[model samples]
Target: MEEIFAICDDITILRDGQWVDTRPLEGLTMDSIISMMVGRELTQRFPEKSNVPKETILEVQHLTALNQPSIQDVSFELKAGEILGVAGLVGSKRTDIVETIFGVRERSEGKILLNGKEMRNRDAHEAINNGFALVTEERRSTGIYGNLDITFNSLVANVEEYKTKSGLLSNKKMKSDTQWVIDSMSVKTPGHETAIGSLSGGNQQKVIIGRWLLTQPEILMLDEPTRGIDVGAKFEIYQLILELAKKNKGIIIISSEMPELLGITDRILVMSNGRAAGVVETKNTTQTEILELASRYL
Candidate 1:
């Protein structure tokens, strides 16, 4: 329906010496005109993901290597405001799948698309730049910096955007944003200056989610977001996730808890080994299917 495009016109103001503009296009659309331009590179990117009238998610269609311990030749699509749950036991590759989507890990085959457009593989930074965010499972090690103050940690992911001078962050902006998230998420903290080491597990998890929300990603990858947190806090997180969906953010939640996934996801995906074992409608399927899908790891 919508046309996705990239601006790749390069007249090359500087020749070899590099004294002029050499930036590539941010978005390129492959139209009839564009097809006339190169048309040969189509084989390079394979099936492109920019702009189309389809309910498909630009499925990643690479087979799981025979040696790998997971499903093979699986594909699926996700839509805006949809909450998809990935349910599997530890080592089932659920986390690995989401991590690869967030660029924390690598994938040998398959493609990823946003709104039907092929996604660029530029690591986590590229994914974030293209409106994707990740809330890591290892929150303590990968998501948050325990040594920093709560306020600093909350805003560190977005400090550069609030820079006042030549790359120097504006502390005031950071403090205000951090405070906003704390209040919005109902985080229990002394203030922005509180050390992260002092917060409870639930509060700490809230901070991690808050950090990613500040990036304004359209699609959020959450890995074990509710793991090891209090029941009340878990409910709050579920509410937040639902709220995010209501706001039209595509969410991929990697959760080990079966009830939690049943309670939230629009659909469920089960991973085995490093493969997508199955994708089932939430209401039509039961936990039995989830168990069967995850059993491949056994």
Candidate 2:
């Protein structure tokens, strides 16, 4: 979440039951909100991702989800190291599109090709096994094991990878892998044994992303990665996304925020009512143009 700044002839900030600061909106950016309000310096800016897409790694053709006719005739291609953004209004079936591609929502008619080979993923496990990972939009309700500790939550997605030939889990490998994610993702907690529910929303999100990364996915789909977090955490998540792209992974992000999607993605797939309205290059497109296409089918 960003700090709410009001603009008129002057800008005003309301914080802690009092008006904190008021200034002209001139020369202001969303980036400065953290320091002006929280009294902490944001040390790192988000890294830039390259726009030149590589080989096409995933293709969805004329896809339709079972029992969900709203997702009709959806098609797109994602290249290695490219960040694709999906945007639409509420009830636009944005979530349904990603879930169908990741195999959580059944596909009634469509073809999913990974490296030119057709994949029929009947369930989430099959998707994971096919080198795909999905970080669902709803974290507390559907993504995480709230009562479980950080270790369990972090390693749960790749549990099968740590199983021995005898079919027993290797706790040592699990803890080691979990530590790597904590260090890599910078997930803050008192200890890895701490309950996931005890952490703040941002850290919880980091843990959720870490869990999906453990699956060693070639395609990573994130639905609203920064929904309820502060701006600082959002920057961190953006950096993580760039880092993933640096590894040549295909990243598909479904976000409601136009700026966030336009800022980070290479190309955007604007959905309207339930169909693919347009796919625009992020570098050349404006929010006005995106919104126009987003409302086409509505």
Candidate 3:
């Protein structure tokens, strides 16, 4: 927005694939722009968080990735109904923590405990079966099958659930689940048969998130969940996260955005050069303290 206001002479607003208006950028405020983009007055930038932290549900102890220059001795506990934010600088290897736990990245040394039992998530399939889900940082590259339609993308994560007695995928069940993803996530698409790649970044992200939700994961990890999304879409995603947290789902969000972490999370685990620098209560810690912790290992 700062960049848009500084240099762009004219601004065009698009809502649900239709052009709302195009005019000079001179008189537009951030709120006005958001209003036009979402087709409504967005009363709040972030929803009022109502999730209360509960008993510890996931524990990562001495979690060190096998890959060099990655997370080391990163220990944290995620409670049911808690949003735990991971904050760090560019090279802090913040994403590595979730990837290792998700089993996409190998773990050299660590113990992952869920409900007081050790979970050996040796691969992505094992991780999913163990009630863990991850929304990777790069949606274009690692998140979605761009060429596939919404139905395929939506049911792909938990496709086994749609298998019939005859060893064939049930199109009826698949359609129902796809519709659920579209409706629950508020994904704007022409139809379930539309290629997921053709949708806007925000809509695509919504579908990806919705896809993960079908698995009914105990612990949900998101890496830069709203990186390329608009403010309106970002707000929607925030609400979804909070709603999940309210349902007692443990959420771990890794973000480079300080305000995002501060705004939504109950607590934050600061990362410093691939290490757990410190954990702070969001209400008590300022960006200054987080930055200080981020620079600790440097």
Candidate 4:
């Protein structure tokens, strides 16, 4: 909204695949624009922080990836029931941190400890078995099966659970879980057989997140979770994250939006040149300090 109001002189509003209004930006406020776009009055941009941090559940000690010019000697601890935000500029390798932890990227040298025990996540399969789930940055390329239906996309990550004694996938279980995703995440879809590619970006993201939740992971890492979504959708995602944190799930979010980090996370981990620059309490740190640390190792 800020960027649109700043750069564009005129604005066009769309609602439910139909055009709402097109008018000049003069005398227009964010609330007015958002109301028009979502067809509802959104009172808050972000939900209030309510999750309380608990004992440490994950520790990354001197983590380094195999790829050259990537994350090196990065370290941080995530406590159960906490929301940890990763913030950095473009090309800072913010996504690499979660990828490395999730075993999407190999770690050349590092120590990952879960519940005070060493964990070797050498591959994505191993990471999933170790109770770790990641929602990748590129939804089209890595997150969802665009051509597949909602039923397939929602149950793909945890398909093993839907198997019957005959070693075949159960259609009844699949339909039940898919319906749960739609209802719990508020995903708008005509039916479970609807192709995921036809849904909007926000609905696709919600389906992906719901899919991960079905796995019951101990650690959840989201990369740009709310990107390209409307304001109402972003607010719902934020509330969902907070709700998960209250359940004692450790969540790590990587976002380019600074206000989002400040609004949702308990602590902000600033990355610089593929390294862990610094970690600050979100309540005590400002955007200026985060930006300063982001450029520290440049």
Q: Give me the overall lDDT of model 3.
A: 0.94
Best by TM-score: 3
Clash pairs for candidate 2: 1-229
Write model 2 residue lDDT over 151-185, tens digit each, in one string.
99999888888999999999899889889879999
TM-scores for every candidate against the unseen true structure: 0.75, 0.88, 0.98, 0.96
**lDDT (C-alpha) at residue 53 in model 4:** 96
Winner on TM-score (1 vs 4): 4
Q: Candidate 1: misplaced stretches above 4 Å?
A: 1-59, 63-74, 296-298
Candidate 1 lDDT over 1-298, as tens digits, reads: 0332333343223211234443334443334223333222332211112211224333455533323554445566777778888987777767666666666565666777876678864588888887888888888888778878888778877766798777777777877898888988888887888888678777888888888899998888898998876454676688788788777778889888888887778789888766677888886888888899888656
Off by over 4 Å in 2: 1-33, 36-39, 42-46
> CA lDDT of 109 in candidate 1?
66
Runs off by more than 4 Å, candidate 3 = none
Question: In candidate 4, which residue ranges exceed 4 Å CA deviation?
Answer: 1-10
Task: Name the lDDT value of residue 207 in candidate 4.
Answer: 98
The 0-to-1 C-alpha lDDT of every candidate, in the order given, reads 0.71, 0.86, 0.94, 0.93
RMSD per model, one decimal: 21.6, 4.4, 1.0, 1.5
In what order do the candidates fall by lDDT, top score first?
Answer: 3, 4, 2, 1
